[model samples]
Target: MMLQDIDAVIFDLDGSLVDSMWIWEQIDIEYLGRFGIALPDNLQYEIEGKSFSETAHFFKERFQISDPLQKIKDDWNEMAWNKYSYEVPLKNGADSFLAYCKANDIKLGIATSNSRELVMNVAAVHGLEHYFDCIMTGCDVEKGKPAPDIYLAVADALKVDPSRCLVFEDIIPGILAGKAAGMKVCAVEDAYSEAIRAEKKELADYYIKDYTDFSSLY
Candidate 1:
C-alpha cells in the first residue's frame, strides 16, 4: 500500500492507540469474580471494538447474567475512566506517528467501539484529541466494528472515500470493520490483549510491530 493514495487514516483506540486494553482485563477479573464466573479467555478478542452496552448484552446472554448490565458497565467505566488520567499509556510511537500524519496533511480520526465520552477522555488525556479531525464512537452508529457502520460514518465525516482511508487496528473485529467499510486495513500487535501477535494473520492487511516510517502505505 502507498501512502500517497490515502487521504485519511482512521484509528481504533483502546489497544490500538492507548494502553487501556489492560484495564479491561483487570475489570474482567475483579468483576466476574463478584459473580463467581471465571473470565472467559476466549471471548476477549472477539469482543474488542464492542460498545459497553453491547458487551453487557453479550455477557447477559453468554453467562446467563441478569439484565441491566448497565450498572456493571457503569462501575467498570468508573474504574477505567479514572485510570486514563494517570495510568493509560499511549502505544509506543503513537504520538509521534500522529504528529507525522498531521505534518504530512493526513487527516486523522478515531472510530472506536468505546463510548464517545471514554474515547474523548483518553484522547484528551494523552493530548491526542487535537490530531483527530473527527471522532466517531460506537454510540454514534447503529452497529460497532465488524459492521462497517462506524467506519463509513467516519469516512463521511472526514469527507474521504472509504477506499482512500487506511485503518490501524489491534483487533480482528476492528480490521473486519475497516475492510467491510471498503478501506485498507493494517494490524498492530496488542500485547495486553488476546489479539496475540501470532494470530494477527487474520486481523491486518499489514502487520506492524511498531510505527517506523510506517505511514508510507497509502
Candidate 2:
C-alpha cells in the first residue's frame, strides 16, 4: 500500500543494493596508473553511469590508451571479480527491503550496468541468486542508462507494465533511465554519488537515504 499499487520493484545493483561503488574508483586509479597516466579529478564524473563497455571506450579514447576495448573490459572484470565475490557487502537494510518485496508479492528484478559474469558471480557468492525473478544487464540491451533501454528490458522480462514498476537507483543516469521508462524512480543515497545527490533527488520521483526511509514508499 505504501508503494501505491506498484506491481514490481527493480533495483540498480552497485550503489543501490550493494556497497560496491568503490571498486570502480579503485580500478580507474590502478588501470591508468599502469600507463603512468594520472587519473583526472573529473574522470569519475565523466563516466559515472556508463556501462562497462562504454567505460572501456571512454578510457581508450579519453586517455589515449592503447589497450583494446575488450582487453580493458576483461582486465576490469578480472580485477573486480574477487572484490565483488568476497568483499562487496549489501547496503544497509537492503536484505530487509528485498524480503519485504517478496513477502508482499512484488516482482523483483535487477537492471545493472555491471557485466553479466560479475553480476551472476556476486549473486551466487552472496546467496542472492533466488531473490530476483529477472536480472538484466546493460549489455543485454542496445543502450545503457540515460537511454531507458535496460530498464525497459527488465520490465519486459518481468512482464510488468512500466507504469507499475518502482525503480531504485543511486546515480543520476539511472534515475533518468527509470523515468524515461515511465516508472517511478527513487534515488538511493550512496556516498560515491554524494556530490550529485541534489541533482539525483531533483530528477527522481522520490529519494531515500537507504531502504529504512520508508516514510514515503519502498
Candidate 3:
C-alpha cells in the first residue's frame, strides 16, 4: 500500500492494533456463565461489529438478562481490565509502524467498536495515547462498523478527507466500514478472524499479515 497521498492512518483497535480479540471471547464465556447461560456457537458472529453498548443491549435482549445495560457493561470491563492491561500486547511490529507514521508527519487515529473507557485504558497501558490524534469509540457515533459512521467521524475529527485516510481493519464489517467511508482499507490478519480470510482480502484494497510486512516499503 502506498502512503504517498495518505494523510491519516485509522485503526480498529481490537484485532487490528492489538492482540486483544481473544480476551473478548473469554469475557463472553465468563460473562454469560454468570447468568447460567451457555454461550451460543454463533454469538460472536451475531455481535461481530456491534459497539460496546450495542453488545450489552444484545445480551440483555437475547439472553433475557435482568441486569441493567450499564451493569452488564461494567461487569465486562471489570473482567477484561486485568487481561488487557497485562496480557494483551500490540500487534507484531505495530510500534514500529506507528513510529514510522509519526516520523512521516502522518496523523493517527483509532476508530474502534470498543467502549471508550476500555480503549483508553488499553492505550494507556500500551503507551499509545500519544500516537493518536483522535480515539473514537463506536458508541460515540450513531452507528458502528459495517456503517461508515465511526471512520468518517474519526477522519472528520482529524480534519482529513476520508479519501486521504487509510484504514487498517481485521474483520469483514470493519473492512467494509472503511471502504464505505471511502478510505483505502487494508485487511489485517488475526487468529480470531482466520475463518473469513479470503473474504477479507476480496473486500479490502490491501491485505497484510502484520505490520512487519511494511518493512519493505519503508
RMSD of candidates 1 onward, in order: 2.7, 2.0, 0.9
Pull out the clashing pairs in model 2: none
lDDT of 2 by residue, 81-189 (tens): 8999889998887877888789889999999999888889878987888889999988788888889999999999999999999999998889999999999999999
Predicted model with the maximum lDDT: 3
Per-residue alpha-carbon lDDT of candidate 1 for residues 155-197, written as tens digits (9 for 90 to 100): 9999999999998888877888998999998887777645366
Give the clashing residue pairs of candidate 3, or none.
Answer: none
Question: Which is superior by lDDT, 2 or 3?
Answer: 3
**Candidate number with greatest TM-score:** 3
Model 1 weakest 10-residue run by lDDT: 209-218
Least lDDT summed over 10 consecutive residues: which range in candidate 2? Answer: 209-218
Candidate 3, position 121, lDDT: 95
Off by over 4 Å in 1: 64-69, 193-199, 213-218
TM-score of each: 0.88, 0.93, 0.98
lDDT of 1: 0.81
The residue-level lDDT of candidate 2 at 140 comes to 84
The lDDT of each candidate is 0.81, 0.88, 0.93
Global CA lDDT computed for model 3: 0.93
